[model samples]
Structure formats: structure tokens, C-alpha cells
Target: MEIKDSVVLVTGANRGIGAEWVHQLRERGAAKIYAGARDPRSVVCPDDRVMPIALDVTARGQVLAAAELANDVQIVVNNAAVSYRQPLIGGDVDRIHAEFETNVFGLVYVTEAFAPVLRANGGGAIVNALSAVSWFSFPGMAGYSATKSAAWNLTDALRLELADQGTLVVALHSGAVTTPMGDNFPIDKIEPTQVVSAALDGLQAGQTEVLADDISRVIKSTLTSDPSRYAAILGG
Candidate 1:
């Protein structure tokens, strides 16, 4: 679906890729944008076309409230997520659970609440900000990787289930981005604008999955390979 003149809602829009998406969507001629953040006051977009909404996706009440307020939305961007750095087995289980709360359950809640909204608006689109880690695990980020993997599956399942409704479900997978989420990671990072652009482009082109960067593409290519080989790489 064309983004021009569409009403779009982006979660985590206070900063990072979500913020970039809000700006780029405006540039693409989006009629209205609901920028959702834990603290709506933190959203810096000053346009009247941009409405900042208080939304903590992990909170069911906030999610439902945002959905009600943005019922005219034609597109929903699930960009809010949390990451906890630790090993899987002996890791901080509490932190891992927190990560799942925000990254996995939050996403599900938001999508479920907005599914009907999208249907009412004539079957629009849902964009999920996934990660390269969704395809491969990384040391010290095992919990984060697991959540993203679950999100990837959720995206796929939603795509299939929402097909009859004409709701386009798109998943964008990439390596670390130049955002707070990428802090302390020594690897090269892509700009948030690049990720947003690629995802919007894919949405316009009717793509269900967008591998937004080289790292994501490379990791996805390994899915068909011997599981042991990929496991060794992650283990090392």
C-alpha cells in the first residue's frame, strides 16, 4: 500500500529508527502519524500532522488506549523492543523475562489490538522491526535473539492469518543500527534512515519480508545450511 496520504502509527517513536520512520513517512506524504512512546512528551516531532501518544506497549491498558485513539490508522509499525545482555543458561533470568515482556508480548498485544483497526481502515499494513539476530544467536544477547526469533515467527504467522483480510504484514530484519540499541557494539551499523527507507520501500513493493542490510541477508541465507555449522559460529 502506498504510504502517501495514509495514517500511520509508529511505536517507540521517541527516538532511533522509530523516530526516523516518523520523519520519513512524513516525507513520503503520510497524511497523519501517531507517534507512540512510553513518554509521549519525549517525541520531538513538531508538526501538527504528528500526534504523539503515550504508549508503553508492555502495558495492556496503554496499548489499548493508543489503539482507540488512533483508530484511523492505516499502518502500524511495531518498533518498540528491549534487549538484555547475558548468556542463555546462566544469564539473568529476570532481565531475560523483562526483555520478552517488551520485545515479544508487547508486540503481540499491540498487533492484536490494531488488527481490527487495520481491517476497518480497509486492510492496511503492519511493519515489524526485526533483527539479524532473529536468524542467528549472538553471545551475551541470547535472550534478545530468542525474542526476535519469536517475533519473526509471529510476523510470519500474522502474514498468513491476515492474508484474507488484505492486511499486509512486513518484517524488516537488519544488523545493529546506529541507535541506542547498538551502543557498545563494535560492529558496523546502518543508519536508522536507511533501515526505515528500505522497509517503506518493501511495503510499497508488496514484500512480506525485508532484509534491510547485508548482515541480515547473510544470516538469512544460512537458514538452509547445516544447523551445526551455524551453531558453531554462534558458539565461537
Candidate 2:
């Protein structure tokens, strides 16, 4: 769908790629932007067209409330995510649960609540911020990687399920992003604009999945190999 003049709701709009999504969507002429953050006051609206929403994607009540409030939304950008430096096993179990709560279930709640909203608004689009980790487990970030892998599956399943309604479901995959999320990475990272621009380009072209960087493309391409090669890329 053309972003120009469309109404959009982006979760985790306070910082990182979500913040860039707000900026780029505005640049693309979106008529209204509902910027959602855990603390509504943290959302910096650039204009009256940008509405701040108090949303914690992990909270089903908040997700449903946002859907109710942004009834005219034509696009939903699920950009909220949390990660931990813990492994899937033998690490901080609390951190692992927190990761799943925000990264996996949070996304599921947002998609479910907004599926009908999008359907009501003539079957719009859903943009999910996935990662290269969605394709392979990073060395020490196994817990975070598992949630991303779950997100990847949901992205694919959502595309198939929402297809009949003409709702476009897009999976945006990238490597290290130059955001707080990418902090301390030993490898190169892409700017937030790079990620948002690529995603918008794909969304405009009606693509169901977008590899926002060469690293993501490489990770995806090597998925069928017996042993994934991303470990080597990260010097694992």
C-alpha cells in the first residue's frame, strides 16, 4: 500500500527504528501517525498528525485499547522488541521470560488485535521488525534469538492467513542496527534510516518479506545449510 496519506500506528515509537518509522512515515505523507510507547509522554510527536498512544505491547489491554483508539489505522508497525544477553539455557531464566514476553507474545497480541482493525480499514498492511537472528541463533544471545525465530514464523503465517483479506504482512529482517538494541555488537551495523527506508520500499512494492541489509540476505540465504554460517560472521 502507498504510505502517502495512509494512517499508521507504530509501537515502541520512543526510540530506535520505531522512532525512524515515525519520521519516515511522516516524510512519506502519512495522514496520521499513532506513535505508541510504554510511557505515552515519552513519545515525541513531530506534528499534530502524530498521535501519542500509551502502549505496552506486552499488555493485551493496551494493545486492544490502541486498536480501539486508532480505528482509522491502515497500517500497523510492530517495532517494539526487547532482548537479553542471556542464553536460551543455563542463563538468567528471568531474562529469557522477559524476552519472550516482549518480543514474542507482545507481537502476537498486537497482530491479533489489529488484524480486524486492518480488515475493517480495507485490508491494509502489517510491518514486523524481525532480525537476522530470526534466521539463526547468535552465539551468546540464544534467548533473544529464539524469540526472533518465533517472530519469523508468525510473520510467515500471518502473511498466509491475512492474504485472503488483502492485508499485506511484511517481515523486515536486518543485522546489527545502529540503535540501543545494537549496542556493544562487535560487528558493523546499519543506521535506523537504512532499515526504515528499505522496509518502506518493500512495503510499497507489495513485498511480503524484506532483507533490509546484505547481512540479513546472507543469513536468510544460508538457512538451508546443515550448519548455519552466521556464527562465523559474528566470529562465534
Candidate 3:
């Protein structure tokens, strides 16, 4: 849980939240950061602690290879995700499939591949990047919401499953961040650096879930009493 001198791996580290996580981790004095990306060459930070690693989370072979390469990694930040602006009933099936491939299935693959490594290293921790959409409906991001909801449950399951091994699992849910993923939205967004910084602090403090923005904090607090409030947007 300690970020200082921790060996960490961050997926989708080329840009957006993932890239910000890499930078923040270095600032936290991480011993090494495996910056996992589809094209590792794109990671341009000059820090020696940053190790750019080629990893396509959707590909089983690539994931296994990355695990082999970053054998010392004790903490994992599953920050890679894909979102397609599509409604469940009206969206293209191909787009929905694509989102699931990266957002849900890919996360599962990465976790599976890294589980042994984490256990071997004395069971450190896993932090999954989720979204506020998992708690409430967004008009055109139903597919993304569905996948993130699955990821949220996945985080819970992993937490319980890995508990005996002493591994900590943290699920982070938040409204849009000021990254490429939220560039098209008009809502107020938190900076990616701030989001990642808060996440690291929460992890070290042994928190299970992190609501990185006010919107996410309010949604999580209100979900139990007003689950139906989200249905209003879905026309329930």
C-alpha cells in the first residue's frame, strides 16, 4: 500500500489517467514503474524509475509477456479502458463488443495474469479504475456504464478472493476527468493529476474505494436511498 519505493505497473500508461498515474507514482518515490501500453515507445517521461513496457491488456500473450518482464511489480493500477458512445438498445453491437473487450474482459485478463506475481511478492495491492457511470446512468454511455459496473463487482470479488493472501484491492470511481476521455463532455472535470494523486494517497491509507470527485462522492453516498433517481435519466 505504501507508494514510496513500491514496484508498480500501470496499464494504458501512454496517455490520459494512466500517464498521469505514472508521473504521480514517480513523484511518490516509487522504485520502479512499469508503464504498460500498447505501444510502450510512446511513454516519454525522463524518469529512470519509469519502465515503458509493451502491453496490450486484451491480448493474453502480451499480458503474460508483460508479467514476465515486470516480475518485481507488487502494485498494479488497472487504468486501461475503452468507451464507445452507444446506448444499450440502439447502439452498434460492434461498438459495445469493443468496449467489453477492453474495459471488462481485458481487465480480467490482466488481473489473472498478475495475481500470481502479486502473491509471490507477498500480496501487495490492485487498484482498478472505474467510473461514476457504474452508479448512475449516462445518456449515451450505457455500454461503458455496463462494463464499469462489471468491473466494480470484479474489484469486490477480487478483494474477497485475495484477502487470505493479504492482497488489497481498491476500486476507484469518479466523474469525468480532464483527460482525453472527458474532452467531449461539457461537465466540470477533475484534473488527471489530482485524481491519480488522491488515488495513491487513498491506497496508502488502506482504503477500499476512492471517490475522486464531488460528483462521485455524492452518488456513492446517495445510491442506497435513491437508486431510482438515476432511473429518471433512463426514463423510468
Q: State each model's CA lDDT, in order.
A: 0.90, 0.90, 0.87
Clash counts for all predictions: 0, 0, 0
TM-score for all models, in order of appearance: 0.94, 0.96, 0.94
For residues 120-195, could you state the per-residue lDDT of candidate 3 as single tens digits? 9999999999988777767678888888988899999999999998899999988888888886444678889778
Q: Candidate 1 on 170-193: residue-level lDDT in tens?
A: 999998899988773457789998
Q: Tell me how far the alpha carbon of residue 155 in candidate 3 is from the true structure, in angstroms, after superposition.
A: 0.6
Error of 3 at 145 (Å): 0.5
Q: Candidate 2 lDDT, tens digit per residue, 50-109?
A: 899899999899899989999999999999998777555689999888889999899999
Poorest lDDT segment (10 consecutive residues) of candidate 1:
227-236
> TM-score for model 3?
0.94
- Candidate number that wins on TM-score, 2 or 3: 2
List the candidates ranked by TM-score, beginning with the highest: 2, 1, 3
State in Å the error of residue 1, model 1.
0.7
C-alpha RMSD (angstroms) for model 1: 2.1
* Clashing pairs in model 1, backbone N/Cα/C closer than 3 A: none
